[model samples]
Target: MLAIGAAVLFAIAFLINAADMSTNDVFTSTNVMLIGLALLALHVAGIGNGWAGRRRR
Candidate 1:
């Protein structure tokens, strides 16, 4: 799920950059892309896998 969210964020950033759209400093393409990368890292680290059950032994 977090990976999916990151993908969406990446797409949004790409579009914003490709279209040459102007945005606030906080919402700039680079910031959005960085946020997406953070989310991707979290996903890779299993931060939001949605599975909290103990492993079977």
Candidate 2:
């Protein structure tokens, strides 16, 4: 599930950032962590419910 994926991503980012609290971490940990949060927001907004489904006339 996308939520699970996002959770994993967030966790990984946290680990990376924690391991190297520097501005030059290889993974861009802050960015990745923000991305994960965005994913979580999407999932919370019901991304799985076919928000893009076209209305049937």
Candidate 3:
């Protein structure tokens, strides 16, 4: 559930970046992209941690 929420948030951020890019806001778009990627990485890592812990038990 948490992962899904994070992913949705990331998607929204990505969309914002895309829209900004289309409007020629390169700097802000790039920042948004970076933030989205970071959030996605964290979300995936969190899910992996949860799954791995369950498997180890």
Candidate 4:
């Protein structure tokens, strides 16, 4: 749930930044958005938060 909220926030930021990039030619915004989407994708696929990189107690 929190992740979704973060994704939404990031998405809005992404859109705004993308618009800015159109005139400024910057990559930071795109990179951040991609990272956010990637994390959300992992979460949705149930592979987030060190799922395979950690052992459950």
Best by TM-score: 1
TM-score rank, highest first? Answer: 1, 2, 4, 3
TM-scores for every predicted model: 0.89, 0.65, 0.40, 0.45
lDDT of 2 by residue, 1-57 (tens): 668878999888888778875655545888888888888888898886455768988
Candidate ranking (lDDT, best to worst): 1, 2, 4, 3
User: Whose lDDT is higher: candidate 2's or candidate 3's?
Assistant: 2
Task: Give the Å shift of residue 21 in candidate 3.
Answer: 6.8
Kindly report which residue stretches of model 4 are placed more than 4 angstroms away from their true locations once superposed.
1-12, 15-27, 49-57
lDDT of 4 by residue, 31-51 (tens): 667767776777787664453
Error of 3 at 36 (Å): 0.6
Write down the lDDT of every candidate, Cα atoms only: 0.97, 0.79, 0.59, 0.65
Give each prediction's root-mean-square deviation over alpha carbons.
Answer: 1.8, 4.2, 5.5, 5.7
Positional deviation of 25 in candidate 2, in angstroms?
Answer: 7.6
Report the Cα lDDT for residue 30, model 1.
97
Q: Which regions of candidate 3 deviate over 4 angstroms?
A: 1-27, 47-57
For candidate 2, what is the lDDT? 0.79
Pairs that collide in candidate 3 are: none
